[model samples]
Structure formats: structure tokens, C-alpha cells
Target: MGEGNFNWSNEVLTRLISQAGLIALKLVLIIVLFFIIRALGKKLIGSAFEKYQKKNTVNAGRIRTLEKLSINVFSYALIFFTVVTALSNLGVSVTSIIAGAGVVGLAIGFGAQGLVSDVVTGFFVLLEKQIDVDDYVTVGGLDGVVEEVGLRTTQIRGFDGTLHFIPNREITTVSNHSRGNMRAMVDIGISYDDDIDRALSVIQEVCDKVSAEDSSFKDGPNVIGVQSLGASEIVLRVIGKTENGMQWAGERTLRKRLKEALDVNGIEIPYPHQVYMEKKADI
Candidate 1:
């Protein structure tokens, strides 16, 4: 009887060890598969973006946004499936766990509604092409360049060096300034005594020079005659169409050149003057 008991005990120990080894092996396989799938998914996304860029069929910013979103979604999905599979291999009932989670999610559905809305809105934002990564836009009353468009939120970098992470659902209206050529408008002011025709001619010469020297100008820097007759000066307007995001630089360059030309031609820019008269009162 004692010998029989010893044999039974030995068999139990061996089975336990075998079971543990199997579980460990499964866990390792799960981990390895996760990494493999993740790498392949990312590589696929990169290849797609590269192809799109080469073809020039889609906007570069749009391609980049899609690539980033795809990679993120793929990684999340892979991780979730890997965990569930691993749990099931370890003798856990994944189906039951998922059902329980669903019940809990339903109970908290109201609280999670905002999160759902954000995801839905983000999906639509990407689908509609309303805004793209690196595009200058005004959304939610904030003007900035979009850094990233994630599933839940968007990151914008403001001109003042502030980074704002806004929920996608809150972006009700988007004004994208990078979709087409931007207008560069510069108003030059000269003293009223200056020759209007001469000033216009000098400005035209400067505009032509700028248009020739800079490749950013897409349309004319043509003068629009006198814009306004101010109290002390006459304002002349010059306008040009420039590549998106190059309008400010073009405007500055044009203004500088216009000023130099005016100065060389003896045109005076009027400034506010206050004259104080001292009358000698009969003492």
C-alpha cells in the first residue's frame, strides 16, 4: 500500500510540472506573435504611405495622418487579441470575461458616451479630409498647426509655442488655411504731398522685382491703386498669391523692398505730428 501511494504522488508531481511548462510555452508564443504582428503592421503602413507619396495621388499630410492612425489602431487591436488568446490558453474563459466587460460597459455607457463620440468624430474628420496633420487650421476657437490626429484627440501646436490637446468631438468647425494658395496683402502709406502716380510706379517696379526674384508668388503682386485717403497719408494696396504658409514671408519681403524703393525715390512716409505753438503773451 505504501509503495502504491509513493507512485501516485510521483505521477501527480510530473503532471503538474508538465502543465506549468505548457502554460509557459504558450505565454512565450503569444508574446512573440504579438511583436511579429506589430512589426509587420507598421511596415505595411509605412509602405502604403511611401507608395501614396510617390504617386502624389493624395495629400502628403493626409497620407501621414492615415499612416499614423492605422499603426495605432493595428497595435491596439493586436495587443487586445494577444491578451485574450493568451488568457484562453492559460485555461481562462475569455468569452465569459468579454461578456462581463460588455455588461459593465453597458452600465457605464452614459459616462463613456463622450469617449465614443470622440472616436466617431475623429473617424469622420479623417474621412472627410477637413484637416490634416501639419495643416494650419482654426478649430474650437483656437488657431494652430495640427501636430497629430489621434483616435480620441488632436494635438495642435500654437504659434505662441503652446501645445493643445483637444478632444475630436469638440472640433465643430475647422478653417483650414493650408489647402490652397494664400493671399499676401501689403498696404503702403505715403505722405499726401507725394506723387500718387510716381509712388504707384515705384511700387509696381518693386512688385515686379519681387515677383521675379521669389518663386513663392503664384499670382501678381499688382497694385490696386489707392486703398484709402488717410488723414496724413495715402494708402496703396498691393496683393499677391503665394504658396500656402509663405504669405507672411512674401509680405514682409515685399514691404521691405517697397520701402527701400520709396526711400531711394525720395517718397516720404507720413507719421503723426503734434505741433505746439508758443505765443508770446503781452505781459
Candidate 2:
């Protein structure tokens, strides 16, 4: 009986050693497969993406995100297939496993509908070019420059330097500020007593000089004439079209340069004032 027990222990030890060896082999093989998938994906899918980016002149941020996403996706695909192959080597029936997975996936699909929708929407966004990295946009009440666009979400950096992560599915309407030329608007205030025609002429002269100096101005920096008569001033509106991404800068420059010009030319910009009366002084 002791001899039999010794033989049983030997068998158990041998089996344990064999199982450990197989697991180690599988792990090594999986690691190799992971790298192989990454290399191939970069050469194949990533190469295609790179070419597309070059052709479309897509921003670098989008290109990098896409390349990374592609490599990861391929790595996962390789891992899945490698595991199945390893299982088949160990006498596991892949057919039965696939069948089981199909059912499980169907159930998970129903339960994770929102997640699936987000991924689907993200893919569409990438393919359709509805949005791209570096695009200044307003979406879902958040306005920012797109930092990264991913399969599940979009990242934006606001003017205030805040980073925002927005789910792709939640982005219903997008206002792309960099699509075309932008408008620069300025309403110059002058005292109501100042000559409207002369004030307009001065403002127009400033606009022309600014436009000529800065090529950012795409269209007329024309004076649109009097917009409103305020409490103590006449608001003369100045309008200009500037190249994409230069609107804000142009508007700021317009204000600074116009103010200086007005100041130099002695244009009277109005200030709030009050008058006082004394009955005794009048007598």
C-alpha cells in the first residue's frame, strides 16, 4: 500500500510539472504573437492609415491616435486567435468554444448597447471626417480645440486650458470654427457730437491699414456705418473677414490698433457723465 501511494504521488507531481510547462509555453507563445501582431498591424493597417493621413493632410494628433488604436485592435485580435489555437492544441474543441462565445456575445451586446453605440459612432466620426484633431469646435456646450479623438471618446482643450473628455455618442451637433474664414467684428464708440462720416472714415482707414499689414484679413475691414446711438456714444461697427483660426487675434489687434489711431487723431470717445444744477448760483 505504501508503494502504491508513492507511485500516485509521483504521477501527480509529473502531471503538475507538465501542466506548468504547457502554461509557460502558452504564455511565451502569446507574447510572441502579441508583438508579431503589433509589427504586422503597424506595417499593414498602420501604413494604410499613414498614407491616408498624408493624402488628406489630417492632423498629427489624429494620425497618432489612429495608429495606436489600430495596433491595439490587431494585438487583441491576435491574442484571441492565439489563445484559441493554443486551446485547440490542448485537445479543446474550438467549434464548441466559438458557439458558446456567440451566445455570450449576443447577450453582452444587448446589455452593453450604449457602449457599442459609442464605439460605432466613434468609427463613423473617424471615417466620415465629421471632426478631427486640432479643430476648434463647440459641441454639446463645450468649446475647445480637439486634442484627441478616440474610438470611445473625444478630448478637447478649452481656451481656459481645461481638458474635457466627451463621449462620442453624446456629440450631436458640432460647430467647427476652423472650417473657413472667420469674421472679426468691432463696434467703435465715439461721442455723439463727433462727425459720424469722419469717424467712419478714420475707422475704415485703420481697417485697411491693418488688413494690408496682416495677410490674415481675407476680406474687407469695411466700416459698416453707425450701428447704434448709445447713451453718450455712437457705435460704429467695423467688419472684416479673416483667415481661419485668426479671427480672435485679428479682432484683438483691430481693437488695439484702432484705439491707438483714434487716440492719435483726437477722436472723442464718449464717457459717462452727469450734470449738476444749483438754484442759488443761478440767481
Candidate 3:
């Protein structure tokens, strides 16, 4: 009876050891396969991304978005296949697991309807070429330079050095400021007492000087004579068209140079002043 008991105990221990070893071996194989597959997948994806980047017809932002999406999709598919294969090797029934996963997925999908919508809209935005990375744009009352266009969010750097992360779905209207030539305008207010012809001549001379000096002055610092006659002064408008994204710089330079020239030419930029009258009090 004792010998029988010992034999039974030895058989149980051997079976347990064999099962554990099989599981360990399978795990090692799965890990090895995962890395091998991952390396190959990355190589394939990288090559495709490079090709996409090289295509001049495609925008850079679109290329980057597609590349990231491709890599993510490949990784998720690989993981799913690995898990299913590992389970199958362990003699687990996959059909029931798949059915259970489908139910869970349905619940998740219902909860993530907005997220799905955002992703879909982002894809359409890329396809439609409405905007791109590095574009200066105004969307949702916020104006900024686009730093990144992502799957669910867009990053914009505002002039005040603030970074705004905007949801893809919230971007309903986009006004691309850097798409074409931008207008550079400066309104110079001159004292009403000053000679209009003299003021106009001084401004024209300055505009000619600026046009001769700066290649960035595209159309002109041409004077749009007498835009407004304000209470204190007559406003003369200097308008020019400049290359997109260079308007602010051009405007700033033009203003500075024009101010200095006006001061030298003795054309006054008028400021608010009031007149006082001394009269006898009414009886």
C-alpha cells in the first residue's frame, strides 16, 4: 500500500513538471516570435512612411498622420494575433473568447462615440487639405500657428507664446492666414493743421525709399490718401501686399522707418488735445 502511494505521488509530480515546462517553452517561443514580427513590421512601416514623405503631391502633415496611423494599426494587429496564438497553443478555445471580446467591444464603442467621431473628422480634414502643420490660422476664435496636427487633437502656438491643444471635433471653421499674400497696412495720423500735400509728399517719399530698400515690400507702401478725418488728425493709410507670414515684420519695419522719416520731415503724428475757453458766466 505504501509503495502504491509513492508511485502515485511520483506520477502526479512528473505530470505537473511536464505541464509547467510546456507552458514555459511556449512563452519563450511567443516572446521570440513577437520580437521578430515587430522588427519586420517596423521595417515595412518605416519604408512606407519614407515613401510617403518623399511624395511631393502629399502634404507633410498628412504624411505624418498616415505614418503614425499605419504604425499603430500594425502594432495592434500584431498584438491581437500574438495573444490569440498564445492562447491557442495553450489549448484554450478562441471562439468563446472572441465572442466575449465582441460584447465588450460593443460596449466600449457605444461609450466612445464622440472619440470615434473626432478621429473620423480628423481623417477627413487631412484628406480634404483644409489645413496643414505650420499654417497660420484662426479657428474657434483662436488664432495661432499650427505646430502639430494629430489624430484627435491639434497643437497651436499663439503669438503670445501660449500653446493650445484643440480637439479635432471642435474645429468647425478654419481661416488660413498664411495661404497667400497678406496685407500690410499702417494708418498714420497727422495734425489737421499740417499741409495735406506736404504730408502726402513726405509719405510718398518714405514709401519710395522703403520700396527701394526692402525686397519684401511686394506691391507697395502706396498711400491710400485720406482714409479718415478724425477729431484730432487726418489719417493717411499706407498699404502694401507682402508674402504670407511676413506681414507683421514688414508692417513693423515700415512703421518704425516711417515714424523716423516723418519726425525728420517735421510731419506731426497728432495726439489728442483739448481747447479751453474763458467766458463770462451766464446770468
The local distance difference test score of each candidate is 0.93, 0.84, 0.84
Which consecutive 10 residues in model 1 have the weakest lDDT in total? 55-64
With a 3 Å backbone cut-off (N, CA, C), the pairs that clash in candidate 2 are none
Q: State in Å the error of residue 5, model 2.
A: 2.5
Which is the winner by lDDT between candidate 1 and candidate 3?
1
For model 2 the local lDDT of residue 23 reads 78
lDDT of 3: 0.84
Encode model 3's per-residue lDDT on 92-126: one tens digit a residue. 99989998998898999999987888888777877
> Per-residue alpha-carbon lDDT of model 1 for 46-72, expressed as tens digits?
998898799887888888888888888
- As a TM-score, model 2 comes out at 0.80
Summed backbone clashes in each candidate are 0, 0, 0
Best by lDDT: 1
Q: How much lDDT does candidate 1 score?
A: 0.93
Could you tell which candidate, 1 or 2, scores higher by lDDT? 1
Top candidate on TM-score is 1
| Candidate 2 local lDDT, 1-283, one digit each (tens) | 9999999999999999999898778778777876776676679986788789879976766686677666656767787877887777677899998989989999999998888888998888888777777888998799999877878888889999999999988988888887879999988899876777888888989998998999999997888998998888889998999998998899999999889988988898777778898667655
TM-score for each prediction? Answer: 0.84, 0.80, 0.73
